[model samples]
Target: MTERIGIVGGGIVGIAIARALTARGVGEVTVLEKERRLAAHQTGHNSGVVHAGLYYAPGSLKAQLCAAGRVLIREFCQEKGLPYREVGKLVVAVDDTELPALAEIERRSIANKVPRLARIDDPAHLRDIEPHVAGVAAVHSPETAVVDYASITEAMAQDVRAAGGTILLGHGVTEITVDGDTVRVATDASEHEFTRLVVCAGLQSDIVAKLVGADPSPKILPFRGEYWALSPDRTDLVSGMIYPVPDPRFPFLGVHFTRGVYDDVHVGPNAVPALAREGYGWLTISPKDTWESLRWPGAWPLAKRHWRMGVDEISASLVKRLYFGKARRFVPELRMADLEAKTASGVRAQAWGRDGSLLDDFAVDRIGPVTVLRNAPSPAATSSIAIAEHVLQHHLDLAAT
Candidate 1:
């Protein structure tokens, strides 16, 4: 007998799981997407850089999965003739103060076993990799690549369909109920029944998880990351991805420059507290979403701790010059004029605990047959395939059988 499976959210993670399950002949897979198209949210709006396991702690799920996922995604992209470019990445340390953090990153990268990872201490050698980038020292990850994740998600959807799966677009999941051996998923248009359900509802993860009677302690706090495209003339300034040594105090990777698969360079993605879960721009607001964030027990404590950072982020968001200044740290040639226009922004569904702690690693909760992806931010797209394998083996307990 075929086991029926329902997956909520059409992002890369959910679609990747669907493809994996169908390939294994585990069950009949059906993907439910709220939007008219797939990858319309975080997956679409992301910077599309494939991480090389540089920042995660050693032995953590993120480190394990990210390292494996990069290889898997590269292979998948090759097999599908997708656009995958190994443009490389340099984690630059500007001053002696940042060198310690940069060294720590190197240690973590070594522990993660990132292939072809090299540390460059000579200033002249550092300039050889990225001539425009200025840094005292740098850790270069040559394997770090970029691809169109939205296109990959679409290809995964195609594989799901070819393997006898169903994909229903614009089907917003509103409720989930578990009744003994079966699970029922309610959407705006209709309802679905299956033996198992997986919720990968990115921005709305908390709400969707709660609908299925999952814990709501680690609430989702949306952080809008706005990007700026480099002017066509200045695009030549960046050869590849040039990033700063991330501040240990914050979870954000800080503002950096990334070259896309098409060879266009982009800067920024400054993290700011978003007013709504789906807030993509300054003008977009949701009163209810704002109230929910404000009312959460963790919200006040989190605000108290990070208020200064929050104020700084807001100032940068409001002033383009301030934002450009942050990115100019690595590339001194970058001017306010180089920031031509704003690009698409993404809202990260960052999870926060009642104790006011940010969940840094990937989190998933399983309540009976329902598996909820509570916190899956950066590297989630890069680790989608590995995450699917981990979810099936650990969370869903389907690998052994």
Candidate 2:
């Protein structure tokens, strides 16, 4: 194995891949990150809830990896002495209309092979688990956890470095060309050649894939997920995570309650179109980003599809009462005063097809010397280790030959 594996992106996924490749003693692993530090984008901005593999369809990559990733993540956290907690998640059906969907979710969880999942028929049982939540029935997924993903990413980078791998910061890859047996990567700083390339460039994944002469087909539509942290006095409004039954038509999970690893309760990560790729707030907009959003064919279609939902989200975003009111539906005790405008937003690197349909599964495409990840979201943070393994098994090993 005389090949060097060049990875673009320094987010958690890229860091995990680098670490995994290094541990395998795969010759040389070079990670080129555009930022000064790792996890500067989506990895650092998320709600920090490790997924429980409950929401995705059975047999999909998202379901399998998320279920397996939970165990792997718990073990990794324990081994590394990292901070994490498997506090569990509760998906509530507030009315009879949602029970069928809730049951389907439970069935899907079983199919995904997640452990400790059960249906709570009695409101008393729901109250015992989540005292503040109001629901007729709920699905309890106790394997879900929360952690500082940035910390995990940092540890992965350290492991890569210790394994004689190079992490190049502040180096944005500008161009890529495949020669006979080598791939040349041109960055803003310099150029390097590698025997293979793997791109996990979070928000820039589609663009980076294009640079490698791949079909650059999936368009990365960045959706800003904004959160509201509960005021310290009102932190007891809910225990663990309390989620609503998601809209089947949409790719996003509805706004829910998240108790972070830091002990703060987060609410309202409403899916809204972002003005900038790295936009974290209502006012954070870029000229180029605005231009891109205006021109993306999927933008109008997505907006049209989610028009009413988008209007409601914008209303919630503008009105604090409306935002807290939504949260109050799940946890009746939560008040408007309990909410503080602790604004932190994550950019979901959502891949959209040319016809404007949202891709709902983990996408991996390999062409010649390059392997691309076009759609990696939600459980991507939870499933990163497994995703790395999957990539290595399916793409890297094959590309090496």
Highest-lDDT candidate: 1
TM-score of 2: 0.97
lDDT of 1 by residue, 102-148 (tens): 99999999999988999999989988999998889999999899999
By how many angstroms RMSD does model 2 differ from the true structure?
1.5
List per-prediction Cα lDDT, in the order shown: 0.92, 0.87
| Residue pairs that clash (backbone atoms under 3 angstroms), model 2 | none
lDDT of 1 at 381: 95
Report the CA-based lDDT of candidate 1 relative to the real structure: 0.92
Relative to the true structure, candidate 1 reaches a TM of 0.98
What's the lDDT for residue 202 in model 1? 92
User: Stretches of candidate 1 above 4 Å error?
Assistant: none
